[model samples]
Target: MISNIAELIADRIGTMPASERRAAQTLIANYPMIGLKTVAEFSAAAGVSSPTILRFVSRLGFQNYPEFQSSLQDELAAQLQSPATRTLNPPSPGGGTVSPMLEATLDNMRETFRHLSDKQLADIAARLADRRGKTFLIGGRFTDPLARYMAAHLAVIQPNVFHLAGQESMWRDRLIDMGKRDVLVIFDIRRYQNSLVRFAEKAHQRGVQIVLFTDQWLSPIARFARHVIAGRTAVPSAWDSSAALFVVAETLIGAVTRQLEAEGAKRIREMESLR
Candidate 1:
């Protein structure tokens, strides 16, 4: 049985026909979220025909679309089942509706940290601490602010932190060097942009170490990422929550701060002195 339907789709997405590939990318990006939504809903969202989505599903080795959805739910049961959304929950003992939202945010942070190993965090911290290589950070429309904020935080304790938000000229200059021992940190969640994926692929081909902070749905960029931090984002709202994403940014700042030691401290002191 295919325990990882998302990974299976991701594995074969590159070779799928154009229309099928579009539908598959949407499915992979939303992951089990797509599982709860019907084929019609998914097709409309993917801008593809229902038959295209079905063929994409069948190609993934499922008997039918319903079977595929079932596999996705089974594969991602833990993530899909959020405590905040559970109907079995008693009314807040405090007798208020607001507590669940706050508690879910805390839970998001806890789950994010729980899955990330200390060693992995430390290694990524080490890469960020490198002064020999320039650090370039980028993210999609929704995630760009987080990337910018991380760059700001890194700059306080280190040199060579560059935040790249797309302006055609800026991207051209920033990406001029390949194989230059630079670190490219990307924050890519759902609705994954092909532009970012292509850039990441190109960077990887040029020996850039890509650090990716992404939703657990995972992206094609995962194949090229040197460091992949997958976090869960659950909220009661229509939009995807970025609370867990902030936890990761803060964690990276904390890790890199500690990893830099004397030099990092001295840089902070000097920066503060000027202020």
Candidate 2:
């Protein structure tokens, strides 16, 4: 969710002590362009001590220097692969620059898929296929489209699929009313919204089953959720690409739909006749 590191730094710069402002400025100015440069490298570039860099990261809400660097690297990688960057330096005829971008996206997806165990998928499939539970799909801001898509697709083949959208004031309290028989499926990526976290926390307190689809295992909301499915979508264009996430969402819905068709077809027909 940290789309522009510079902008993020700038927004928070006023809160930082005057001593750290210069280091913060340096990060804002030359973040995505710089590779995996160490804190020492950044410190030298910013004409500050490494400890100052550490403080700068802490001030920005990162747990430590290493965590800050990891987040920055992900943001930088996305920025570099953005279409705007590619357009700035067009490849020569038949040079095939797009291959690298494509490969990077595929590699990310492969790593994410590898990280998921069969047991995890099976458990998630079971939850999604459960007819007795109400499935609440929640996403905010940039990820809202993903949640809506999943909810709509699943609704066609499953019952009790709900998409939580619109203003938080209107839906937040209602969403929390879900209980143990309900599952909350939340999609959150980097630069995640605070409101989503609050909603997840509330849902967790109510004993609702929580399924999270996110970019990394280290996501802050992961702890509150019952299941975590890592979506290794490419980070490009200062925006996280949800291509892989969408694929996973659809695949999950498809699996659950198949199960429902196999297990509940007769009941589903009876219910449909009542409607």
Candidate 3:
């Protein structure tokens, strides 16, 4: 599975013809810096044909160049957010013209759902339905909203759902007591937080089951996760479009809710009667 977008592009370059490799190299170097204005604009900037850009993207497992570029931009945003790294390019339209951000968001959502197989969705739902254990969500920085959203929805539908609270130190304290019976749901996409990865690793050591919602299969946090669900966050700007992530989050919640309603309706009815 492709891990990082850069590695995907590099692999494509290795197999591509010499001329295409040069174009790919140019695109890689200039991307997230100069920013991709459009297909024709990128073609001119990369000194290659638009068809070559399409091929490069296809080689990376994307349908076309736009998809590939969007993913790259998302990854770049993640990395640039780190205090150690400076953002090379500010979030701005390269051609001094506004591009359709909403269109890109809708396209990303469409592709994300298209690529998600029914089996994968079912599997995730099953994981969430494991009522034998507690579900704990861990997310930091840009992804905190996702974790909070999932945890809140799950809490109402499923018992024993917990969102990691407090500062990093508080989370660390809570992690010290976590064990295998607990499920750790982590959201770590581009510009991933190191603390989240550490939490996953520690949780893994305790035999905790991890479910990761991230941008790619090769995300570092995926290494220790039991289940990894991929979501497309690439957008026209430096920051990722959360539309895809939100869709997946809602899907997971809906599936889990339906499962509970089907299998645990009697329990729910009893509890409601007492209330």
Largest TM-score belongs to which candidate? 1
All models: lDDT? 0.81, 0.77, 0.77
Q: Rank the candidates by TM-score, best first.
A: 1, 2, 3
Candidate 2: C-alpha RMSD to true structure equals: 18.8
Error of 2 at 131 (Å): 1.2
TM-score of 2: 0.60
lDDT tens per residue, model 1, 1-275: 22366657767888889999988878767765875688899999899888988898888888998898777666567545775544323344664566767778888888988989989988899999887888889888788898999999998888888888767456646666746588999988887878889888888888889999888888789999999998777766566767798888898899888879889889888998999
Which of 1 and 2 is ahead in TM-score? 1
RMSD to the true structure for each prediction, in A, is: 18.8, 18.8, 18.8
lDDT tens digits, residue span 1-275, model 3: 44566556665677888656866777668755433567677778778887876776676688866677687777877786895644333333454234467668778888888888888888878878989888899776888789999998887667888999778888888876678888898888878888888888888999998988888544698999888877888777878766787888999888888888865576667667878
lDDT of 2 by residue, 78-156 (tens): 7577857533223424655565566667877778778877678778988988888898998867888999998887887
lDDT of 1: 0.81
* Residue pairs with clashing backbones, model 2: 1-190, 1-191, 78-235
lDDT-better candidate, 1 vs 3: 1
Stretches of candidate 3 exceeding 4 Å from the true structure: 1-99, 262-275
Q: So what's the TM-score on candidate 3? A: 0.60
